[model samples]
Target chain A: MTPLLDIAELAKRFEVGNKRLLYAVDEVTFAIGRGETVGLVGESGCGKSTLVRLINRLLDPTSGSIRLAGTELADMRARAFAGNANRARIQMVFQDAGDSLNPRYTAADAIADPIRRLKKMSGASLKSRVEALADMTGLPRELLSRFPHQLSGGQKARVGIARAIAVEPELLILDEPTAALDVSVQVVILKLLQQLKRELGMSYLFVSHDLNVVRLLCDRVLVMYLGKIVESGPAAELFADPRHPYTRALISAIPQADPDKRVGRLRLSGEPRSPIDPDPTVCRFYGRCPRGEPRCSAEMPVLRTVASARQAACHFA
Target chain B: MTAVPALAVEDLSVEFRTRSGTVKVLDHVGFSVDKGETVALVGESGSGKSVTAFAVMGILDPAGRVTSGRALFGGADLLALSEHDLAEQRGRELSMIFQNPRTALNPIRKVGQQIADVLVRHGGATRPDAPRAAVEMLKRVRIPDPERRVEAYPFELSGGMCQRIMIAIALACRPALLIADEPTTGLDVTTQAVIMDLIGELAHESGMATIFITHDLALAAEYCDRIVVMHAGHIVEAAPARELFAHPRHPYSAKLLAATPGETVSLAELASIPGGLPDLRRPDLPACRYSDRCERRLDDCARPLPHRVIGERHTVSCWNPL
Candidate 1:
């Protein structure tokens, strides 16, 4: 079966003050099937944002290929891609769109912007479609006229989601969608997104730092470290027994409410190895890995198959 | 804890004179922190958790007034102290860590100088001696290259490093009580764990009472010994950490616990708390704030909020608690 979205050897880099090159995203590859939810989990400076931007075409990739339904996305000019025919096929919902939503625009107007720009629908149809999107996102029609200041956090989040899905995108890129919401409200939004995925048959690339939320929502998970895809596996399988050492530390750090379960400290200390002008010879997790050996510094470990449906970039795995 | 609590608040009511009207931000909010104990103030935004902390710290906003309450710290009512006396007591016996360390830290000043300022003012270090003492505090918080990082501005450091500086400044004088208001809100999960570990270690070493104000129930469960659930300026429930998570008595708490993402059976089991927070400005607000959102609300809930003691340390303000 053809994947809804596919990428190969994707990389993005930036020059820092003419002295060093920052590998915002190193060589990485992944895919998402139709209606599948794949989570991207990583810490700060791990290139999670860079990967999402590359896939969504918000930022141009330095090299490699991105195929959505077999159409090449990387070759188009950056400005041209914005107005490309395939522009409406992929959409993004950013974190804290509460602040991102234009203060001058009402909730309805915010949701209608994408529809007008992408779909070219106006007048009565646009108004009706805006209300429909609001309804689909669990936003009340009555609150449509309220400006951003007048709307609650959850309501603003709904407007953001409603806007992103207004054009009926096949794949939705959610960058920490529920990161700014309270737990109670977060659950509601997560459920809403899940239901919408099912109803609309849309694929999702859910990027978040919260592993528990990822475990609950994602079908598969991709773990990144210092601009590289360190591990990938089915969500339940990966979370239950993470193969990579970094994955283990990330999982151990989650603060669980269950008191009967006590987490042993797999504390990751010190900053991650510099992404700027990284040594191609050494493993990214070398300095911080608790299980680090002499061999780790001598060679960079590639993502080797660890299980039937899992892979991890670790020598032991 | 042998005689007087490290800090105690009673029947605290606070109001803000907003343009609309007097907003009752906190009502009958009370909690106590024993020596070396960590209490978590957990609730949604606008739940008055932060307001309770601000009221106790005697740092209420200009428009805000503490109408009725007694904040007893070291047997002295903090509410009754003059501004001068309150200022004197603030950093010496009581200190707080705000949510965003970047914004809280002075942008123009060197991070080292900021910590030194706290040391000189509260820790009784002389001006000439404060910088070295500040570096020692930084080392205690486990910052790498403390000497070099001390002179670095807050912006030069990463989010985690800035948070460490904030922790160092807050703990400079080893205050008896520490109020951390969403200290790790904007940090990554890994960094959040590290920061919490630092706070946990420092609090244990110094035997300081801590009131951790946050919206994350899971984080509170992991760090705090006691959990205080607030809603619309009222203490809905307070209980031992394990007991509360094992079996929450209040409807709001059960919903909050279920709503939190964990190794849950399924997302369908999760439920959002229905309805919005009661308008504090409204005179006709319900006595039980959760009643508007509670599925199991009873007529008795309308009379007046009833405080019930379930276990030795468990308390609830619901008429028909689960």
Candidate 2:
């Protein structure tokens, strides 16, 4: 069966000073099945956010294709895609709800903006739809008239989610939706997203650096570093036993809630190599990988099937 | 545990005078830290976690006033000291690591010079020796190529590196007390782990009493020896980390633990707290700040809350605890 969203060999590059090119996203390939949640986990500057932006058409890809339901979206430019017919098919809930929301707009108006732009609906119908969306997201309908400043963090997050789902999109891209919230509020938002995905039957692309949250929310997880997908596998299985060395290190870095289960962490000492004009032949995790071998630097490790339903970009794995 | 706690605070109340009325920011907030002990003050945004740190550090804003309280540091009272006396102790005897290093640091100055300023200002280092000492401090924080990175400005470094510099400056004087307010809030998990490791290491070497302020209970449970849970400017519970998580006494503490995104439970099973914190400015504020939203709240909760000692180190301020 065709995937809900399929991206192959997608790349986005930026030219830095001195004519050096920075590969923000390079040769990335992934697919999200209908009603599936795919997690993108990476360290800072690992190109996870760039991949999501490219999918959302917030950034245009320099190469490769993005197909939604087998429909080509890469040809459409970022600005042009806004008015394109597929605009409502893909929506993004930004990371910081407080800052992403317009302070001047009320909660009702914030949700209504997407519907207005995509559906071009106004008047009593629009108002009722906004209230309905709020209700679906477990937001108090009475607070819809209040501005963003008046809402609590969880309420603001609900407003953000309500806005993204206003158009009833098939694919939802959440960029660390609960990163700004407290633990008490984060679980609520996470639970709400899970329920929404089940009820709406929409595929989800969750971009976050938090492995624990991804473990709870995602069906499959992808680990990226320096513009490449290093590992991909079933969420629980992958975390239980990571194939790639980078994935192992990333997983070990998560502080376990249980003190007795203290992990003998796989510490990666040096910072990741510069992405600017990176050597195409060298593995991205070579310098930092504890089990680094000469073969890692001589040739890039491509993603190869490793287990029953998993892949890792490591020659040794 | 010792002759005296590294720092002891008692009946610390704070208020901010606003245009409309005086807002009570803290209501008799109190906690203690032992020398070489790490205690985390965990709470939501308006829980006054940072305010407690600011009050103890004597750095409250002009609009804010310490209505009542006593903060005993070593032998001296931190609240009784004048501004000038407090300044002497800030960088030397006690220091703080702010939330965002990018904003907390001086953007214009080179990262090395910033560290040198702290060392020379209050530490025993002389003006000429401060720069070299600063480089050594950077190396201690495990920043690679200290010599080259020393001259790099704050803007030239990444968020994690800037945070390392912040840690370096805070630990420069080998302070007796360290206050880290959300030190790893915006950082990546790996970087957060590294930064936390560095803080733990430095605190041990210097025997500094650390008050880690964060909203992340998982992190607090992992790193801190003791946990102090706050709500609406009041400390709801305080206990050893393992004891608190294993069996939370206060209703709010239990709710907070349930709300944490641990993999042990399904997403739907995880629950959120029922309601928001009570308005501090309300004329009829309840004595128990968490009573308004607590499921275990009883009529007795409306009366003045009393501290109930459950265990050796565990205490809860509630009429009906879990």
> Model 1 over residues A23-91: C-alpha lDDT tens digits?
999989888999999999998889999898888888889899999999999988667888887889999
Per-residue accuracy of model 2 over B96-202 as CA lDDT, tens digit each: 99999999999899999999999889898898999899889989999999999999999999999999999999999999999999999889888898899889988
Candidate 2: segments with Cα more than 4 A from true spot: B1-3
Q: What are the per-residue Cα lDDT tens digits for candidate 2 across A209-292?
A: 788889999999999999999999999999888999989888888877686677577777878899999998899888888988
Candidate with maximal DockQ: 1
> Model 1: how large is the Cα RMSD against the reference?
1.3
iRMS (Å) per candidate? 1.2, 1.4
lDDT of 1 by residue, B266-301 (tens): 788887888888888998889998898999988898
Q: List chain B TM-scores, each candidate.
A: 0.98, 0.98
**Error of model 1, residue B205, in angstroms:** 1.1
